[model samples]
Target chain A: MTGQVRTVDGRVAGRRGQATRQKLLDCLSEMLSSSPYRDVKVIDVARKAGTSPATFYQYFPDVEGAVLDIAEEMAKEGAGLTDLVAGRSWVGKAGWATSEELVDGFLDFWRRHDAILRVVDLGAAEGDKRFYKIRMRILNSVTNSLTDSVKELQAKGKVDKDISPAAMAGSLVAMLAAVASHQKGFTTWGVKQSELRPNLAQLVHLGITGKKPTK
Target chain B: MTGQVRTVDGRVAGRRGQATRQKLLDCLSEMLSSSPYRDVKVIDVARKAGTSPATFYQYFPDVEGAVLDIAEEMAKEGAGLTDLVAGRSWVGKAGWATSEELVDGFLDFWRRHDAILRVVDLGAAEGDKRFYKIRMRILNSVTNSLTDSVKELQAKGKVDKDISPAAMAGSLVAMLAAVASHQKGFTTWGVKQSELRPNLAQLVHLGITGKKPTK
Candidate 1:
């Protein structure tokens, strides 16, 4: 069973408290979208949420704590990304479809949660273990599934044996993430969103199968 | 010809003024490394630099302005990355070496400037055009050359005709940048630095040539 949501003072949250906490998080999310992460303050979040800073503090310790709570929620949602690759064939026409769908799904996920993900990425880059683990938690779902697919293909002699499945999968996922974070960057380079998906899927297919997709 | 450095007030910097400016930038860089970009303040940077906030204001309007100054300097240095790919052969054994060296050099540059690059990336992700342009300035050295290489390969029927040269090159550059930023993530996944280089090189080779390296 899921544990009850608790306050910073160790009080179990009832429905009203939960609503207040969620409102703070939602307001914080908006602030993150409209300004730099560093500029987000508990006072601003409280004001935006129509609450008090003491109420914000009661729910979480600081800006980072609240950010972590949001990232945790997003990570749970990210776990569903595994279905984009789980039990999917990586052979021929079917393989190309898998790659395309994976690219589509992954990019959409990143776009939806990019503001929080950016902060998570910065925290991780700054050597914050909690943020690092949360980022890993999100990416691991798809990464683990992709790794399994690569290992399976390697066993079938379809992929180069020397290719480290983990490294390959990690790199591809990183590519999807990097590209997703900078999706607008591609536009500056004259590559459209529609044009980018198939190319990424192509690279994904090539990385996994070591052969061009049949499609 | 290069223009002389100037203060925020548009006064051309003399030797002493330029020295003070450089000192401020150095302190700002150190602060960036030790703290999150969001928490860095101009007053703190001025204090760290052994200067007054007024002096800091003389050279730069704020922390973001100083950060942009540093990013510009780094991007100029990053233009040297073009040598890693310009006129490089993408055939047979030499091609493999090119891939390995590119990965090596790119990773080193990114690791060296990871802190500032993180801010640049965050800015770009937040849709700031100035930061995005700077990020592109750094990446385009390698990307432009890589695009030309891909285009050449396609013309000769070595790479896939359908592949968008810009997209492929952009994706590859993004992969290198992403992987470099998250090198620690790889170690946590049990992939060593030594193991990662070859796999990335292999990917770079496969992506560029559309075939395994002869090596």
Candidate 2:
């Protein structure tokens, strides 16, 4: 098990303290969804949490620190996305199903976590190592698994020798993520959700197997 | 031709005024490159431009307005991205060349304007229609041309019938944009620039043509 949660002042947080800390984090998260990340103030989060600013500082050093806490939890959950591709077959009908399901699961995960994910994206683009680490943790989980799949296919001579599995996997995963983040943009372009998933699935399958899906 | 450039207070900017305005925008752009968006204040931008905050205000209403001005100018140039895919043949060696050049050009464009593009992306993801429109202007230039290519290929029985041209084109373009924005991320993943370009070209060719490149 992980060690006990601690306050910023170096004191270990008990059950009650941990509960209060969680409450603050949740409030900060809600604020992030509604306001710009730069505008999210610690006192406002504390006020929304029905606690004093001092109580908040006891848990998090600042608004950014609290966001990192929430992102950490999300990354832990994101690591589970490895299931979408790991051990999945990439041939014929099975390949199509795997691709479709990976698209569905990846997009759903992005939608559920878009708010904090946006902040993490911005922070990463701004060259913050902490945010870059978090973004990498999430993308790396899926990309690494997909890379292994490609390498396996290559070893069996089922895939081209010239393809860099890491680049292919990373690009495909990045596409899924970029598409997921901008799903709304597609809708505005008159492309519905139903049309999107299949096309995305097709690209994913083609990128992996280098052949059209049997479906 | 576009209308004469005007300051926020209803005065058409003269030559010297236009020069000053451009200097402030250039300084603001530099500031965005080095500082977080939220932390960027008007005073800071003015100081960097060697002007007072009042002079900054005379030309633009606020920092966001200035950013919008910069984005607007960039969008006009970005519209030319259409040339990358418009009327490009996706057959045989020509298709591979088209894909490689598009990837190269797209990545280079993204790198040159990354700082402003990051803010535009964040604003669009935050649901700002102004930023959304600018982004759409750029992506649609490519996506529309690509969608037409897919549809033409499908009509000639060169591509599959099940493909949604718009969705396919949009997803592929989104992948390009995402990969372009995060090019540095790929390097950190141990994928070299040389490795990335060919792989991205392969995926683009595969997605558009529904077959592996002959290369």
Candidate 3:
């Protein structure tokens, strides 16, 4: 069972306190989307949330801390991404379907939480361990499953034995994450969304199964 | 012919002016690597360069403008990356070597300019047209070339014609950028650089040729 939420001052967040905290987080998220992360401030978040800076501090230590909270929530939701790959087939037309669905699902998830994810990415890139762990938590949800799928196929002589499954899966997942983050860049390059999806799925299929999809 | 460098006020930069301008850019680049992009200030860059903020203003309008200047310089260098694939054979062992070298070269370029590229990535993700254009200038140097390689292979009946060459090349380049940006993340995931590089090269090879490398 999950423990009850608590304020920064170590007091349990009652119904109203929790409501206020959620409001602050919502406002912070919106602020992040509209402005750069470094410019987000306690006063602005509080103002947008219809609260005061004192109330903001009562719930979270700082903007980074609040952003971490949002990232953690998103990571929990990101765990659901495992279903997109777990126990999925990597053979014939079924494999193509799995790859297509995985790209579709992953891109959709990333686009939805892009603002918070961007901050998290910057934090991790800056060598912040807290943000790094959250990023791994989210990506690993799908990566670990995909790694296993590759390993399983390799064991069954369907994939190359020399290939490192973890690295392959990690690279593929990184591609998905990178492509998802820069979706607009692709569009501007004249690659349509519909075209990008299948090409990515093709690469995924080729990487995992070492063959073109039957479909 | 290259034009003379000029100050923000439209005065041509003399030797000393250009020196001062270069120093400021170097200082700003250092500041970006050491701190969050949003927190990087003109005053800080000016102080770091041992110049007054007024002198800093003589050459560049703001941090973003200065960043674009650095990005433009990098993009020009990035155009040289075309040599990694232009007119190169993508068949048999040569294809594998090409993939390996491309991965190595692309990763090195990204790692060297990561601090600035991170800002570019953030800017592009935030829908900033200036940053997006700079990013395109850099990636297109490689993506456009790789797209041609894929199309060439498809024309030879080596790759599926149904696959979009641009999308495939774009995804592969995006993967390289993503993996390079998060090289530290991969290490933390227990994937060694030794294992990471070959796997990426393998994926690139597979994606481009629709077959495993001959190596």
Candidate 4:
């Protein structure tokens, strides 16, 4: 659905140019994963991509612009995260399973795109609207689905009427994201992945269903 | 008791020297608040502090070392957050109040130091040990207290025997922190601050006690 890829100079990128652009992005992503965001420079990225800084500028305005390109792509893929909670059951054993799968899937997604996500998070936190918009796009998918689930349960008089579905869903999602980002910290603190997952799932189940999971 | 302050060159900082050092830190903190972390340079901070780059170098190795100093100071103050949860009651109306107050205090602290916290979060997520340690030190006080609370509840046969107190406490604290950092995001997304607090408190209360708050 994205329009034709174009260079910063308003020229449509042909097949060869697109390949070069993608290569630059791949190198940039790798650099981001390995180095501090502040230290990444255009010349270094271009060198790694077997090109010059001029070519890098041809494809994008600057490092931030190129990073935005990468984040947008990840956000598109992150939209599928909606399925992790959408139309899921929140009753009995099925409820526990749903929560478990949701946590597992969400953590996996964050780990996969963590480098770009971290940059997006920092940018958004620093009050950049472009970054904030991308962060919202990626998170809104899961948050909206979870909110719907809470609202449905509330409608059936299962969850408390006083609950704010949006806030609950938002908080739960934020917890998942935070925990996912700091998975290494938990491990070092002596909580194994095996135990961590279930406890997190239980918390999710409790947050949504307002009752401890039977499992 | 901490040792006497020393400069990078191993000389003990005299009163005037310490004043100059602190001024550089104050300028760095202000620059961090107003600009992107990547764009903050030693020269700018020195200029803002009415000092030369050579004078700045006398105290700090670079911009990052100076930032670590600021973060270290903040972490020391953050140790006080322990009182928010330590020995607090988690029963009936008191439990709900505890949860609300924890959320309130944590969010306020995050807002107060968000600029530095954002940098620390970015650094930790990027796998820097020093930043990770600071992040842990700041979160540990409350996480440990909550962990003890859960374990106490479990020992009394109040919480599920299967619950891992550490995991539950870590998850709950992580949720609080993530939500705190993104308070602006929530308000922008239509969750008012007033409704946001109680919903978050409910989630915290439920995660900790495995039951909806009576409030």
Candidate 5:
């Protein structure tokens, strides 16, 4: 009975630790929303989280590590929808259903997290090598999804069978990435998101359907 | 005749100054190709150009200025291509022909300047706002070209009536920028230019044609 109480106590402590860590991350995200990623410091993050420097250190080695953790979390959230479609078979109704759902879901996902997506997009442009790795991981996730969709389309005779799946997959991923980057830069160029979204959706639809809309 | 000789001498001196500046930019590009942009120093660029630091300073205020000059040169090259395509109508036969020619020509241009492209691409990501501005300038050139194409298409009733030409132009420009960024990361990911070029072309084609090719 004593041993059981010790295990329960340990579980509660772990949960509390996790809660603290998450609170810190949430504070960091809030801070980053209004400032450039490079300008934010560890002290700022710690103070904002209502935690001591020592507690911040206990959770993250440095500000970059914390930012990287947030970046990875954002990447995972954006890539999760794609991963779901990548694991499915590439033929029949299940495959088609998955492909359409994933594509539509990804569009919505990018729109929802446009701010964090802007951060990650700009972060990938950093001269650091790790940014490239993070970017490639994100691209790979999108690539896997595109590959599954392309293969399924080809199998169903919906897409050009002559085009290589890998090439099509790469193209789709590239297109989506471009759309995301443009969304990030819209404000600077005096563009509204409402004005950009329909064009982006039209481009995606054009890529898959192969039919140019008649006026 | 004596006045003509003096004028010729002045022209010769001006030409020599221009050549020296070009040589410095060439040297900087070479140095950046083998190293990160942030790692490059003014002394290294001077030594490579076979000039003194004072001479380098005469032309550029700092390393960032020199980088910006090189980026401007690239933007001019990209813009020159658009100027070449501006007079042609982008409808029916001319539309398909102009796009194919442009894509093929661009692929060849990127292939020839892969080293310089890599340096510019890296520099843009290295937190140099000037480099980023230059990249934006390049994209604007592409945007202008697409805008002209869309205008021509709309005049002929070839494009969708609902989509604004400006939005379509933005999307095409974004797509190209994405392709360029992905191509820049290719070597770091063990992907080759030969493997990426065709995919990039297909992506451009997809964006322009609004048709997925049937195998």
Candidate 6:
């Protein structure tokens, strides 16, 4: 036991720990991309990670916990854009930008984190109670950023004041989900990325401005 | 073989066919209410329907096909409402007698079809291509109905002409989906049904009228 511990100590411990975590996440991501979250087990993830089940448990309590970690990490990466938006005036800096930027950014996020998004969607829909709570936390963070933008627009009289920011926030989040859902169906419908961004921008613009741009 | 065929024909061909279909759908409804769609298998559905796996194929080709049939049937039943709306102006008989009536009808739809809605949400997230098509069809139908209403309202000078009817229509559909998704998370968030209708109505009014309600 001491020898085994010594072998995993010092620089090797730190290096191996980081490598193991990345390997696990990568394996989980690959599996979740092709399979349903509920169908993927810890043992499967462990095997895919090139580690034993005991080694897998050393990091996550269970498969869901690992997924939650993946979700949190993805959320953190996506959170950067939200923070950037937060630092600016919604009406002047964010709202005035072309709808393409918004749509493109959103699509990019989905594309970059498609695997984690798949797991998050699955966890939210079918995972246990804890996973759902984590899902809400992610949603709330995203919604808060949107609500802030809406609030800024309302303050500048650019948006309708009569509407509730919370509801609008909900609508925005749902629209994003709808877009993601559409993207998931893109291959089947023979829709290409070239067509997706424009259509999505139109949809988002319509939702936000309540007016369709004459293209 | 002829006797078996005759028995199947006599008992499972006409009214029996309908009964078997209903039984299968009912079993699916029950199973889906408690579990996610992906988790529900054809065998489980057949067993719950009190039939063998072979018999399950008689009515539907697969689980997705069966659920799609059920959704189509529900959509058909709801089709009458759309047709009635199509034949009249927003203030006419088919358009909602009162605000409460409108809210009640919407809530009733959710409550009645909670199981199907769950299936839709589950299937929508899955990489299943058919699920998105089904969702798009529902959205298109609702959008058409809403567009008619928007056109009437615009003609009456009640709705802003600048806002495109199609955009508003998409928002309305997205709103309904948001409300349903919110309700799905109700247990974890402790959301009440009483709060649902008013919020939904307010959002609808905002999207359609482009103005805040007096309430």
Q: 1 or 6, which is superior by DockQ?
A: 1
Identify the candidate with maximal lDDT: 4
Give the winner by TM-score: 3 or 5. Answer: 3
Runs in model 5 with CA error above 4 Å? A1-74, A83-130, A184-191, A212-215, B1-23, B47-58, B89-95, B110-133, B184-206, B209-215
Residue-level lDDT of model 2, residues B1-215, one tens digit each, is 98999998898999999999999999999999999887899999999999999999999988989999999999999999999999888988999999999999899989999989999998888888999999999888989999999999999999989899999999988898888888887888699999999999999999989988875
TM-score, second chain, candidate 1: 0.97
Q: Report the poorest 10 consecutive residues by lDDT, candidate 1 chain B.
A: B206-215
* Cα lDDT tens digits for candidate 1, A1-215: 77999999999999999999999999999999999886788999999999999999999999999999999999999999999999999887899999999999999999999899999999999888999999999889999999999999888888878889999999999999999999988997798888788889988888878888899
For all candidates in order, the CA lDDT equals 0.92, 0.92, 0.92, 0.93, 0.61, 0.62
DockQ of each: 0.76, 0.79, 0.77, 0.86, 0.24, 0.21
Residue B107's lDDT within candidate 6 is 52
> Between the candidate structures 2 and 6, which one is better when assessed by DockQ?
2
Task: Tally clashing residue pairs in candidate 6.
Answer: 0
Candidate 4 CAPRI assessment class:
high
Clashes of 1: 0
**Candidate 4 per-residue lDDT over residues A1-215, each given as its tens digit:** 77999999899999999999999999999999999999999999999999999999999999999999999999999999999999899999999999999999999999999899999999998889999999999889999999999999999999889889999999999999999988888999899999999998998898888988876
Instruction: List the candidate 2 regions with Cα displacement exceeding 4 Å.
Output: none
Per-residue alpha-carbon lDDT of candidate 6 for residues B1-215, written as tens digits (9 for 90 to 100): 33321222244356777688879878988887778655788899898888998887777777767888788777766554454334543443323332334445655676677777656655666665566566656555656777777778898898756556765565456556645655666434553566545545555655555543455
User: Which of the two, 2 or 3, has more TM-score?
Assistant: 2
- The alpha-carbon deviation from the true structure for residue B11 of candidate 5, after best TM-score superposition, in angstroms, is 19
User: By the lDDT metric, which is better: model 1 or model 6?
Assistant: 1
Q: Write the per-residue lDDT of candidate 3 for residues A1-215, one digit (tens) a residue.
A: 98899988899999999899999999999999998675788999999999999999999988888999999999999999999999999888899999999999999999999899888888888778999999999999999999999999998999888899999999999999999999988887799999999999999888888888998
Among these predicted structures, which one has the highest TM-score?
Answer: 4
User: What value does the lDDT take at residue B164 in candidate 3?
Assistant: 95
What proportion of the true contacts does each candidate reproduce? Answer: 0.66, 0.78, 0.82, 0.87, 0.33, 0.14
For B1-215, candidate 3 gives per-residue lDDT tens digits of 67899888899999999999999999999999999786888999999999999999999988888999999999999999999999998889999999999999999999999899998888888888999999988889999999999998888998887989999999999999999999988998899999999999999998998888999
